[model samples]
Target: MAKLFPFLQIHDFLSDKLSKEILDYAEARQADFSPSTTSSGGGMAMVTNQRISMTLKDLAEFGPAIRENILAIAPGIIEQLKISPFEIGEIELQLAAHGDGALFVTHIDTGVHEKSEKPRIISLVYYMHTQPKKFSGGHLRMHTLPIGEDDVQPVDITPDHNSLIAFPSFAPHEVLPVVAPNVAFKDWRFAVNCWIHRA
Candidate 1:
C-alpha cells in the first residue's frame, strides 16, 4: 500500500485570515469560472460539472507562499515515493469550485493524453471553504489499484479548511460528491489545485 498509494496531508497550511482572504477573492471572481474539462481534453459533457480556472493576477500574493511551502516539504514526499527529484517547473495553480452534487470520477492526473510531452510528477490540492460548514461529503478519495485481481481499497481524506493534500500524479483519485443542502455558490467547496511538473 505504501508503494502504490503514497500521500501527504498537512493541516493548517494557511492561517485563518489568509484562508478567508483567498476564499473571498474566489467568490468575488466567480464570474470567471468555467466548466472543468477532463484530462483527455474533452468538454464538460465528458466529465462532471465543476468550475475551474487558472489563478488570475489578483491571486499573485499566494503564488510564492504556495510554491515555497510545497518545495519545503517536497523532498520528504519524493523520498517516500522513491523517485528521483526532477526540476519542478511551471507550478500550475487552478481554482476549482464544487457546488452541490458536484463530483469528479476517479482519474490519474498523469498520462491522460498520449501525445503530451510534459509529465506531471506531483499533484497537490489545498482545500478551503466558508465557515459554519454549509456543505458535507466532499472528501478526496485515493484508490489503490488492484494488484493481480485483488480488490481495491479507498482512503478518504476530508476536505478541511486550510488543509493541503499531496500525492503522486499517477495515483488514481477522485473528489466525492458534495452535499451542499443550502445550495449557495458561496458555500461551495473550494480548492486550490496545483500540479508540479518535471522539467
Candidate 2:
C-alpha cells in the first residue's frame, strides 16, 4: 500500500462551450440527484454520515461522449498506472455535485464489501463548474501510500473546470469541503465520476 502510484490529469478535456452546456444540463436536473451512498462491504449499500454529496445516475447529453473518450484513452491510462491490460467491461458513470460544507472522506474505489461481474480497475473524475467559479475548496486530495489522518503524504488537486483526472481504483483519495456560499446547486462543485471496469 505504500507504493508510489501513478495518476493521469488532462486539462481542458472539453471545449468551453461544451463544458458550459454540460453544467447547464446538470443544473436543470437538480431534482434528479440523490444523496450519495457508501457500501457496507456486505452486499448492501448504506446511507452514511461521512460523505456528503448528491449524485445523478445518468447524464444523457454527454454520457456517451465521456464514455467514448474514456474508452479510447483507457489503455494509455492503465499503461501509465503500470497495470496489466484487461478487456474493458461496463463503464459506470455518475454525476456528482457538492455544495457548501460537503466532502467525501478518504476511500478506495474497489469494493470494500463484495464482488461484482466486472471489478472496477480505473477511476476517472471529470470536473465541471461555472466559469469564475462560485465555489471554494472541494479540492481532491490523493493520498500517497501509507496514509492516515495523522501522518500522510497527499497531492491536492484544484478540480479545475473541464479538466479530467484518472487514477488506479485502489488508490485512496478524498474531497475537501466545498464552500459555495449562497449559490444554487448549479453553482456547486460538479464532477462526472466514471469507473473503468475489467471484463
Tell me, by TM-score, which candidate is best: 2
lDDT of 1 by residue, 1-199 (tens): 3324778888998878888888887888878876676546443333334422223333567777777878888788788766687876666677888877778877888742223456789999999988888889979999887555545468999998899998999888888888876667778888888878776
Model 1: residues >4 Å from true position, as ranges? 1-4, 41-58, 111-117, 148-152
Give the C-alpha miss distance for residue 107 in model 1, angstroms: 0.4
**CA RMSD per model (angstroms):** 3.9, 3.3
Error (Å) of candidate 1 at residue 144 is 1.1
lDDT of each: 0.77, 0.85
Residue pairs with backbone overlap in model 2: 41-113
Question: What lDDT tens digits, residue by residue, belong to model 2 across residues 1-199?
Answer: 3444678899988778878888998999999999998774645666686789999987996888889888888878889989898888888888999999989998989852134566888999999998788989999898887643444357898899999999999988999999888988888999999888887
Q: List the residue pairs that clash in candidate 1.
A: none
* Best model number under lDDT: 2
- Candidate 2 segments exceeding 4 Å error: 112-116, 147-152
Q: How many clashes does each candidate structure show, in the order listed?
A: 0, 1
lDDT of 2: 0.85
